[model samples]
Target: MHGVVQHSLIILAVLTSLGVIFGLVLAYANKKMAIEVNPLIHIVEDVLPKGQCGACGFAGCMAYAEAVVTNPDVPPNLCTPGKDPVAKLVGDLTGKAAAAVEPRIAQVKCAGTHTKAVKANEYHGVQDCVAANLLFGGPKSCKFGCLGLGTCVKACPFGAMTMSEDGLPIIDPDKCTGCAKCETVCPKKVIAMMPIGAHVRVNCNSHDKGAVAKKACSVSCIGCTLCVKECQYGAIKMDNNLAVVDAKVCMEKCDNPTCLAKCPTKAIRQAVLGIVPGNEETVA
Candidate 1:
């Protein structure tokens, strides 16, 4: 019994000694290898929404926070998800005046749903927009129309986008951070960021002029310029067989709203749903 006790003590002592030695080594290594992160970076990071959408030009919230603390050129209002409250907090913390972030929403440019847009062929392979787009520019007869494969829905970090029953994406303005992730991921480039209160918008993305565009999608712009001629304010312009609404003039400067009623195809119309961040039922 005495011999057994002696052996047990020796074993315990050896283990204790090894543990102490390793602990000290780890502590020394940690002190030497530690990267000096700014304390202010963590503060700014805490205030941030941490969506990591990369709208601020930085990689993520942490990287953005670090840049805000270190770089004077980096603005505090860059975080779209964080919006005004976070901007104010960041500005107060960093001692820099933050500008108010302009409210924007993801507008799915293609009004062409399955019912409106004609289909060339049915895709049976992978259920991804990026993948489907590679297959003969997708199943849709209109090459520019949304694939309706939920690639934008997947790409959006914020729960802002949803695939409608019509096989088109419906964007929730309130939830959308305007990070442009959906816009970037869309294979068809049918999603565009529009200012919240912008009155007139051309929902069609098809470049096919008149007859061809109308055959592809019922509601295509067709570059008719009927709305342009009707507009008292010279806000509408034809570019690449697409009607582009000048946001500054139409939404902000223009008083007489005639374009909405004049659009023959009803392509350029008044935004019915909430254009800015507000509570609205996006699912139909």
Candidate 2:
């Protein structure tokens, strides 16, 4: 009985010694290999709204925080969703100049709908716009028009985009962070980032040249260069047979925009649906 008791005690002592040795090793390893986190990173991260929208060019708010905290040159105004207030806070924290956030929103270029744009072939395979586009430039006659397959709507991480009943993507300005995700995801390149204050814009993306474009979709830009000619300010220019409006020159020089009245097919328009008013938000 005494030998049994001594054996049990010996086993307990060995186990206790092993545990202590492991504890010491673990402590030493932790002290030597532990990553040191900067307090400023946490501070900057807390100030941010944590949208993880990647508008700041970083993967997330934490990544941005680490960048701004560690680097003196990284600008704080890259956060589009944070707006002016966040910019100011980041600037104050990092001692960097807070550049004013330009108000930008996504604008869908195609006005071609299910009824307006003539169908070349009925797509029956997949609902994906890119997938549909792979099979002979999509079902729509206009090669550059939006496929209305909800690819953009699905790509939007912020729930800023939606598809209308007429088969067109609609972006809510309030929810949009101007992340340009939809623009990147769109296979047609139909959606583009536009200044919120931009009054004049070309709604069509078709480069079909004059009559061929008109036949495909009624609202498609025929690329007649009428808008380029009518712009008194030289704000409008022709690129790839399409009317390109320079917002900088247009805002300053376009007091009497005759371009709106000059478009023959109503292709060059004020970026609106139904009633093309002089000043109103446009629809796709």
Among the numbered candidates, top TM-score falls to 1
Candidate 2 lDDT over 161-273, as tens digits, reads 88887788877877887878788889999989877766677878988887888899887788887788777788888888788888778777666667888887666566442
TM-score of each: 0.86, 0.83
TM-score of 1: 0.86
Residue by residue across 1-284, what tens digits does model 1's lDDT show?
Answer: 99999999999999999999999999999999999987999999999987788889899999999999999999899998887888999999999999999888788777887788899999998999999999999999999888989999988898888888788887877788888888888888888888878776778888888899999988888888888788777888898899998877887778767776777777776654533211121321
What count of clashes does model 1 give? Answer: 0
Which pairs of residues collide in candidate 1? none
Q: What C-alpha lDDT does candidate 1 achieve relative to the native structure?
A: 0.83
- Score each candidate by Cα lDDT: 0.83, 0.82
**After superposition, which runs of candidate 2 have C-alpha atoms over 4 Å from their true positions?**
1-31, 272-284
